[model samples]
Target: MNSLSAANTHFTFDLFQQFKTSKKDDNIFCSPLSISSALAMTYLGAKENTAFEMEMVGALHFNEVTENTEGRTTRDHVEKLGNVHHQFQKLLTELKKPTDANELNIANKLYGEKNYQFLQTSFLYYVESVDFKNAPEESRKKINSWVESQTHEKIKDLLPKNSLEFTTVLVLVNAIYFKGQWDNKFDKRNTVEKEFWLNKDTSKPVQMMKQVNVFKFTSLEDIKAKILEIPYKGKDLSMVLLLPDDVDGLQKLEDQLTAEKLREWTSSQNMHDNYVDLYLPRFKVEETYDLKDTLRALGMVDVFNPQRANLSGMTGTKDLLVSKVIHKSFVEVTEEGTEAASSTAVVVNVGSPPTHPFHCDHPFLFFIRHNKTNSILFLGRVSSP
Candidate 1:
């Protein structure tokens, strides 16, 4: 019998827990299986395999237009979705080997490979930025543009189109670029605003951004958390933010997380009216990760066990070990709601705006939530966003 190490289990447990809590807080549901798949690919020595998941997802969102009304029947489109799901499952099922030699060899092959079009062809576009380790601005901008185009311009509108659509997006665009500002920025001109608390005793005249619109919101004493859902312009996408009342409540929520808890929290939320005296900073970031080694470091080894595992359905032979896992995700938050997009397919574009000032100032967990299911498509945090 084979098993994950204590440290590895702890890592897995922590990642799952964090994902659950954060997803719950954000009112978004991401497929745990997908995360597991990504993690497992890493464990099987398929360092690039994890990135494949991120980039593919990002690409899906990048080009995710309202399901087109073209001649393709919804049934046919569903079949395509089913085929993708089946292929993904096949990849996961094949990488379950338990031998060290098999696992290590697969890892070497995955890391050594250059042409990862298999992943791209599977609907994943990849991208990355090579910081001069000096982190030159020109290099950084070049890298940013590459990521933007790889995601099919569903991202960074500021980049030069030519310079932006480089191969880097094919590898790193879904890695995670986040930018946010408060829904209610503090104006130097009008610094005098009154603030109010739900409890009158705690009330101070605060600068509340007067807003008018419906929002998905909820308060849970059982969980000690407040959840808010902000929809994107397309309405297909949204940002769900969860704020734990106790500054330390996040850890507790993480520990108490479960599928049931998640379902409960999301279902309990309702549309409501809200007000806020919000002050938040505008912050920008870009993070690229090579999850190949990380997943290998985890405990998934079958899919990448090229020799032992079987994936004949994909490539006709057992030689196809997942070569790389690249992820790039980007988000921009402002007073006009939230806009974000991720790419995991060969190419795609995906995003939004807001009213009032929904300042996500406090320690809050957010998610890039899709409307269809309770599954968190993407999970994140705004410890400072």
Candidate 2:
């Protein structure tokens, strides 16, 4: 579990770096857990070097369960790989466990051409397959409907029109929906329009929700930042906010940010109970991304290239490769609580802080995490209201 958390931290920073570069000066949001889970299912069909590459890029940590018999080293490696997938399955199952107070759903599905020779027995555990050949548009709509249902209609049209062609062989998808009321709810009457600094020279009016309470908080002098953790009703999940001291200090903080650094900043020892006059903006963010180029940039190239790809594990042949990876996410934060949903589709053809007056009057980074597993469910930068 510790290793898995570490891997998630690393992957989160890696994806954040990419997003920072691509969407400069704009707000960004994503579900690293959703993407990783969906790709874990896709990874089931990867073999040899392809498998190794995917494992490394995905940052999936699997404990090695080795048999000591002679010539069993190779067998052990194979077993370890299988164990990795099993762990993902276990984690996904755990995440989907029912919680009445909080509505959380994580689901996976594989849409394939009707005649595609998919290994139903081996792959069934990871993803449920649906035929996409007979009616491509209908199949597309069906997948979208499933995403909608899974996300409580918070996410729609996940796979945009004309994005899926008739030639698509496989499409792997993972959708996650989360809605939790704050352990200490804020009064709606306290929300008021306030100035949100976009930068030194720009500002905008935002509906700022205010509350005064004792929260887990910390201030890092070295980083010029403050950290705060607000628990949701279940206590198993929380939002950790990181805010820079200076309104223009976000870029500097970003320059020094790392998975290890984040771990240290959010460490239990660093957080102490403190009275905080919290002011957060009421905002909604809906983001979509085409990750082919980004994944390739991260050295996940073979999976997207038909000529060099190796996915024989799925169909016992190299006839398929990922054509695109589409991801869509929605988030709304208000006085009551937070509601967020994200969907990641692997198209086949192929493929802070707080506190201390923790007034978030400027851009900042935040994460919705599952406390038990230490898995980051959603990550975003609120550059604007």
Candidate 3:
């Protein structure tokens, strides 16, 4: 369980980097946890395929299991990622449970063709039966409808036209929705038109929300950036923002960020409470991604390649291969709160304002963190907003 957060964190950053490399100047957003959850369902079903399992685990950021305690490093140890089935289940429950303080919903399901014959999963997994062979169109609509309802219709047309052909046998879908109200909610009247720098030479006007409150803040002397934590109503979750000191310094900060380095930078000890002047722009980003290329680039090739793919663990046989992984996520940041794809808790008090100045008037990185587990649910960069 302890390593589960690490896994999610690692994968989150890994996927972020992949997106960063290509969509350098664009607004970026995705829920690595949601994608990991969907992929893990298939990983759990992989049986007797040590190589493929190792690839899946490694690409997913799964750490060393019990078998690798000493100096041992083999495919099997990676494959037998100690009690992973239990950990996956626990991760889902931990993310979705104790929801009163937070509005969070995570829905994961596996749909298989009814007429296709395959082995059952090891962990009493539930694979929803659908007539993909006979009614691919209806199955597609049905799957989309289920996901739409699961996410309160925030996500629609998840499976677009012709995505599910008659030959399609299996599909995995994961949807997450989160609503967070700032503990120290910003005043709407304070929001004013401000300049947001996209780059050294480019800038745009934005509705910047200003709030003077005591917030968790810290300065990175080496990187010349600041980190601030804005808790939602319950404080179980927070929006952790990283702002570069220079208008064009965002790229440098992002380059320096890694899973381990971020832990050190944002550790509880590093951040101190002080009166902060926070200026965040009101923005919303809804992105849909086909992650087959990204996953393959991260060393997960076999799962999508039908000829050499192996997911015997998911079923009793090796007849299943993922056809497509479509991820659509939405996040909106306003003065009142946030409606994003993520969750968490914390206690914050309203008090005096003004000492520290942490302005987000330029491209910045923000993460919605589950403070209890310190797991990041949704991470994105607002390059233009």
Model 2 poorest ten-residue lDDT run: 343-352
* lDDT at position 60, candidate 1: 23
lDDT tens digits, residues 1-385, model 3? Answer: 3566787888888898899998998999888888887777777665444345433446786544322334244356334543555566766787677655568887778888887555643434557889998999999999999989988888899888988999988887888898777877777777899998888888898999888778899999899999999998778889999999999999899999999988998887898887887889999998888898998878777778778777776555667788778888888898778753332222335555447888999899999988888888999999987
Flag regions of model 3 displaced more than 4 Å: 48-57, 63-82, 122-124, 340-354
Model 2 C-alpha lDDT versus the unseen true structure: 0.77
**Model 1 regions more than 4 Å off:** 1-147, 152-214, 268-285, 293-299, 306-309, 338-359, 373-375
Candidate 3 yields a Cα-based lDDT of 0.79
Q: Model 2 over residues 167-245: C-alpha lDDT tens digits? A: 7777777677778778777777778999999999999999998887788999999989998999987788899999999
Clashes counted in candidate 3 amount to 13
Candidate 2 Cα outliers beyond 4 Å, as residue runs: 57-75, 125-134, 339-355
What are the RMSDs of all candidates, in order? 14.8, 8.3, 4.2
For residue 259, model 3's alpha carbon misses the true position, in angstroms, by 0.4
What is the C-alpha RMSD, rounded to one decimal, of candidate 2?
Answer: 8.3
Global fold similarity of model 3 (TM-score)? 0.89
